[model samples]
Target: MAYEGKGVWCVGEVRHGDLSPSLFELITAGRIIADARSETLTAVLIGKGVAAKADEVAARGADKILVLEHDALDQLVDEAHTGALTAAAGTEKPRTLLFSASVYGRSVAPRVAVALGGAVASDASALTVTDGKLTLERSAFGSAVISTVAVNAADGPEVVTTAPMAFERSGTSETKAEVTQAAVDPASWTQNTEFVSFSADESKEIDLGGAEKIVSGGRGLGNADNFSLIRDLAKSLGAAVGASRAVVDSGWIPYKHQVGLTGRQVRPRLYVACGISGQIQHLAGMKSSDVIVAINTDADCPMMKLATYSVKGDLTQIIPAIVSEIDKVRGSSNGS
Candidate 1:
């Protein structure tokens, strides 16, 4: 397939004046695809006063950086951001454009694709350049199945939004990319949407999407009150609390903590499942975790089979003991 664009591009995201951590992961994935196609890995950074952070993106893996700056971009107005990104894409004409599968990315990427008359794939878990064709792997049917799709290169540039924790974050490099400032006229673009005040989630705990360690509860937890055990264990380990779909559907916990195909997909370093039967939907969200520990009474549960460590017991008793042991370990370390 003959490609229309010159190189691979990653759309960088910023939060609180810092580059989004997901940018590095996208860069890491982009590097592989760029190298395979013998093209440069470029990144588009858009935000007011973000020029200073251009080096950060370069250190990760970008071979070049396009910095789009404007006071309007300081706060994320979807129309302004999408317009700027669309302009950058028009100028760069990249063969493949990557966006993080985040709330910001999901809202912006599709609009950019529409403006460029290009194809887009959302929630892509894997990417590859096969025989010069860009093939993306995404979860479908509630993550019970993996679907491999090849984009039509002849159409135009291919835009894709990658799932969270889909790829490892790229390491830093001594080499810095050449940064260029893109000219964008915010006034020229028609924006019906206005930027309003932003309010964050009320929960102070770690969000499930980016947590390194997660302690999750399931239907086997018996009732909503038993979630205390999950929280206690999470607090002891300094981990986030997560929940299976059944638990959330049953109103034992809020949907924010739910982890499954229908909920948030997480790839934590360590995932501890208490009383989870390991339904297929649940496994789809967390099977990518580095280590899985399952505590369940049933030994034949799917989660037990997939877990790196399996403990057979009652979670009410098991979780408290684990939390106690963790506290003792922490206390001893602190005392020393």
Candidate 2:
């Protein structure tokens, strides 16, 4: 079987007429695969007025930028975006396709894969090309185990959705690629679905998914009112606030702050678990963090076992001390 399209392609996500941060990360990952295979790294941008953002993707290591602009794609209707992507894939026939593991990418990638007769790997934390075969590593069994899946190049293009923060954004390239406009007829494609208005849920000041540092509370915080300590520590650290399912269930925090298998998956650079017992369910969501610090009264708790640093004490006493120390350090630094 002969493959027509000869490179790795990334499906970029655009929001508010700009490229999403995850798109840069995907470009980095795609560059790796493209380099391994000695192929071009292309990015497919689908949205109205998205052509202007092609230089951003090109600078971030996209060798070729394919723009699929349409009025229907402006608001991200699953069907419309999927149709445009499917059309692009059929024309390009890239060796591998990459998407962000965001809500939009997760929703559209699988559909495009099915339409193009390809296999899809979702929520991949790591991607590589070994012996010219694409491999994806992702959490499985409620994130208790990591499973690696390999896609054969002999098969069509491999579709992959990468988890946020799994890879750093690619550095700017001195060389740039010219953006090409791809033709996509929305009318020819079945318009079974129509996009309506979108309403964002009440979100935290910091987005948990993309947060580099997080300070999470749990049932061990003792009460809803005591959660202020968690908030204070998070604020001091300039980190997002997270909560275990137990805390959310107990109404100590909103569901948006919940971090677990049933909640949002986070891959922060630093994770501070205060008053959390470190249940497997909660660990499932954050075990991918680069560094974990656990403060719990029980030394034998699971969080302590998994943490890089474990502080054994009462959180109420420990957290305040941490805050004071941070403030003192900042004050001294500012005074100087």
Candidate 3:
């Protein structure tokens, strides 16, 4: 649609005292769209004390930065965030808005859209400006089907939230963006929610989304006690531990370790699947991994077929042998 307003706006997110990893991803995606639409790219940061973070967004490639801060916005209470975003949109008059597909983005996009009388595209994996229209590709039916939708300029301002890891994060740029302090009065907005406190995930493992390497186990591990094999291998490889849905539901592992359509989506440089059958749901979450290694006795399994390297064997023996080999390699390097 004709943003006839000004630039493409990227709504960035801050979580746990720092900018979320997805913020740079938004900038990378938003820059391309802004260029295609012949508009500037602006990053919007709304949070108390977020004004000091504008430089980070600028370093990531935003041509301009808009900061909206208030005591009420110290955390992402929907009422304050939605109100601040809507107010920013009015001031910026951007033709398009992009947000990270996090808890923050998914919640705020629709509310902001309704407030602006605009159409919203949620959890879109890709964004493109074509033939004077904005198009978004989104996954549907538990990620079994991909559907595309386009919005014309006349349909009102475009609002969108991007799926995580859909676009690669941008590297730091040499250019700096001009920061604009956008005015927002959160006191006037209706307050229906309160942020009591931030609870951190107690899991000691590296977060699946950001892990460089992952070793995921499945039901073939036999019992919860046997999961030690998986843990040993993961420890040797210095990788995060993940599990298929079956093991997670069987009480062999916690829900946080589950990796599937219903669980967290991960993109790691190397993903090792032990005993996993590579069901469609599981594949949806990890097929994007740079390299996949599957170990299973059933050579005909889907995981084996999709794996970059397949090992057909007993998991107990295979995992121990792998770990021992790793120890040998490290020991040799240490000259002990």
Best by TM-score: 2
Give all candidates' CA lDDT scores.
Answer: 0.87, 0.86, 0.84
- For model 2, the stretches where C-alpha displacement exceeds 4 angstroms are 1-3, 153-155, 202-204
Better by lDDT, candidate 3 or 1:
1
Would you estimate the TM-scores of all the predictions? 0.90, 0.92, 0.89
Query: What C-alpha lDDT does candidate 1 achieve relative to the native structure?
Result: 0.87
Inter-residue clash pairs, candidate 2: none
Q: Which ten residues in a row have the lowest lDDT in candidate 1?
A: 1-10
Q: Is candidate 1 or candidate 3 better by TM-score?
A: 1
Residue pairs in collision within model 1: none
Candidate 3 error regions (>4 Å): 1-3, 153-155, 210-212, 235-238, 324-336
How many steric overlaps are in each model, in order?
A: 0, 0, 3
Instruction: Tell me which of candidates 2 and 3 scores higher on lDDT.
Output: 2
